[model samples]
Target: MTLYSRVRPLAFKLPAETAHDLGKRTLRAAQSTRPTRAALSYAYGYDHPALEVDLFGETFPNPVGVAAGFDKNAEMTHALAALGFGFVEIGTVTPYPQEGNDRPRLFRLREDRGMINRMGFNGQGMERVKERLEEDGTPGVPLGVNVGKMNSSTADEAIEDYRRVFDRLSPFADYVVVNVSCPNTPEEFDESSPEHLERIFETLAAENDADVPILVKIGPDSPEESILELVDIVRELGVDGIVATNTSTTREGLESPEREEWGGLSGKPIADRSTAVIRAIAEHTDGELPIVGVGGVDSAESAYEKIRAGASLVQLYTGFIYGGPSTAKRINRGLAALLQRDGFSSVEDAVGADLELE
Candidate 1:
């Protein structure tokens, strides 16, 4: 059995958030020295020509990435890259730091291979993240910044919040994701409404002097029609791409005792739904817009399925937690085999391969 498989039982004994913090600290230590970083790369990193993908004017070494919230404060990007992820997205970073929800806010749905969290955008804020990036330099692969407003910010204040974070951090981002879809945050205002989204996109677009590619993150529970409406708005404002999707609020088919926890649901249970959303967006946009598919991706087959359904790239957080440090290397290696088996030359060729047929 794998080392993580053996240790997971012990890790699960701790509160989910505590375990996560400890894991990040270990990774941070690992990346502190070149020898350890090199050792990590030698042991876990994998590459294949067929796994390369070009998206948002950047070449991803592979399409497998660590999703946001995993490195919410930008603490472990270099370590994650050493673990073989093609890219790392840091933050659902807000304009200011917030304590977020109460303790015991993160739960492990072990039986269902999922997790529920009401983290509420807890992080060291944009300025700290920017300073971290500036001091450490970007990781070897692409870096994405997922920006969000403070939980207490009103609708009008929210626009400024997003703009401020974007202005400070976009320089370091290969792409920027405007995260209006996080279900764990306060709902004092309709952040996902068409008018609010329009204001956000317009304001960010105006401030985007560097022309960093901007995308939006959507939730899994939104109706298909509403999703399409948001997609339409993104296209109207000339946004760069879409990250489909955020976690689900539904607990329809969960087996774990923690399934009923109050917050966003992520991991295995939401995989199919996320892929369906990707397919819908792909089919609607006629494969013209880029998509970074996320939600419940834990294996190569699952990641490949999203690509076939139209994801230019895919990200995973809970999967990384469960699969351990070798997750990306294993997934990327398996993807190459899957590509050849399916007669696809590369990951780009596989994207949207099933959309037209469906």
Candidate 2:
């Protein structure tokens, strides 16, 4: 294991929220020209004949991406991209900035190799994030902005909350991710129902005259029935894609001393379940729509499983924490090898290959 991975345990010991900030602040301070950034790019970057694929009209150099909630602000977009993610999704940013929940809102289940966060959409406002993107001299890779509502906002006013961010972040975002899955927010978990989903998706998609790809990130806690219902509504509205699934509400299999801490659970525990949900969405959408899988992915085998199960693209955040900077590059490299061994010409051909297994 690399030194980065070795040091993670030390960071993981602190309060989850505090450690997250320290890591983000550390990354944020490392400018684009920092040697760490350059070394990260060189060590993690990978390319091949079949690695390139287009999602939501944007061409990604590779399939592995950094999931949102990792970089809540836009500060690290280019730097993370420079770190070798094919795409780096920033935010879960609200219309206005939010303090999120109080201290001890985040937890780490080390025994389960997972994390739970009730962070409640803490972030700088969309305008500031957009402003940061505007000021960056370097043009990074494709970026997806995950927009969420303020902690105090009700579900009834969620659209206006989402709209304000989309309006400002559109120019810099290759796609806009409508993040309605945040379990920490007051009504967020229940808001992913068929009717609420339809309203939020249709409203966001309507606001974009440029055909900007609008997608929703759904929680992993919902029933399969609810997921299928969401698929039907999204398909009918021509929603571009879905990010399935988000952190879970369940706290199953947690042996971590901090297991009882309240937050949305993510990482190893949700790996299988998230991919299964992706498979379900793939079946429901019949591969017509894109699905970006984002549950527990710490290896290429996990990532390949997502692709085979039906994710056109895959993302990671917790996996990065567990595996360190080399994680994305490692997954991309292993995916290429898996494709070769499976006799698939490209990753796209393997998409939904696990559907039969499903």
Candidate 3:
């Protein structure tokens, strides 16, 4: 009864952005070639070695990624890394093409599994996602890029639109988020203001010069003291992590009548408020920065409860549009059997292990 749960009831009868542009044109034609991307990596690859994960400097063969608006213009990064995504963030990408927010603006709360787009940062930008990542290359795992800023940019032209999509996709990024908390764009300023996130982390830490790794996506309806004052202005601008959440205008316990669709609000009713904003930014950065969590991820006990509430990594787009393609090999083989049933040997020794039982 799989096969995308029997074709997701005929792709949930279209118009959720046209069944997400016909599932990214069938993952851009099953990643065009190479024996059908090695027959989708021998039918949905799922590596184990306790699902390895190092973090932004690469080495994430697991940590269940695939977040940024589901392949927005970087068209199916190697068919979502041959469907067992261990990384694949694409874009909010802006610095040119946009045409967003109209035509039924994506909605399908299918009895609250959730989804209510308002895709205002619509893509096909950043030089066509940097010429489709220099003609289909960057995916053998880690690839994030989420950069955004052009819903009629202001606030000083949104810092040169995130310095022109992080100077054209940060050399095909292994890390680079910087999406000022999208609630479906256009608020005309104060994009998480602390002086506009310190002029967007001091202009992307001075155009980063290949120091890449520069995360920051935040948004779960704020107030945890304004999200710890934007995580102390993202740890006083040395920024290199934090993507806790980025979709939710909050519809409160929605039962789904497209719950007054305005925008944002991603899967499974924003899973426990995006794991309580990744356990309040991992108990206020005591776990020392780096988070990546993402809202209401789909399985492995909700991505092992945001890697035990500190999320060394996690991401999902409406649970791979309702757990299809063996949803990251069934959530990284149930997160390596829930990290060896909790004795934990890897996944970075179970991230925060429920914040050392508080």
Q: Of the candidates shown, which would achieve the greatest lDDT relative to the real structure? A: 1
lDDT, model 1, position 290: 96
Q: Write the per-residue lDDT of candidate 3 for residues 107-179, one digit (tens) a residue.
A: 8888888888887887778997798789888778889888888888788998988987898788788898888
Q: Which stretches of candidate 1 lie over 4 Å from their true place?
A: none
> Please, what is the TM-score per model?
0.98, 0.94, 0.35
Q: Report how far off residue 8 is in candidate 2 (Å).
A: 2.6
Distance (Å) between predicted and true CA of 75, model 2? 1.3
Task: Tell me, by TM-score, which candidate is best.
Answer: 1
**lDDT of the candidates, in the order given:** 0.92, 0.82, 0.85
lDDT of 1 by residue, 1-358 (tens): 8888898889888999999999999999999999999999999999898998988888999999989999988998999999999999999999898899988899989889999999888899988888899988989999999999999899999999999999999999999999989998889899888899899989998998888999999998989999999899878988889999999999988999998789999999999999999999999999989999999999999999999999999999989878888899889999999999999999999999998743
Candidate 3 deviant stretches above 4 angstroms = 1-30, 33-38, 47-63, 66-72, 81-83, 95-147, 150-156, 159-192, 195-227, 231-280, 285-306, 312-334, 343-352, 356-358
lDDT of 2 by residue, 1-358 (tens): 6878788879867776777788778777765566877766777678776878777777888888999989888777766776668898889878777888787777777789898888887788887787788887334678888888877767778868887888888777888888877778886445666777777766777778877888888878778988888778877877788999889989776788777877788999999899989988888777778999999998989999999999999999888887876787788889899999999998888999878542
**Candidate 1 overall lDDT versus native:** 0.92
Output the TM-score of candidate 3: 0.35
Error of 1 at 214 (Å): 0.2
Error of 2 at 70 (Å): 0.5
Candidates sorted on lDDT, descending:
1, 3, 2
- Give residue 265's lDDT in candidate 2 (0 to 100): 88
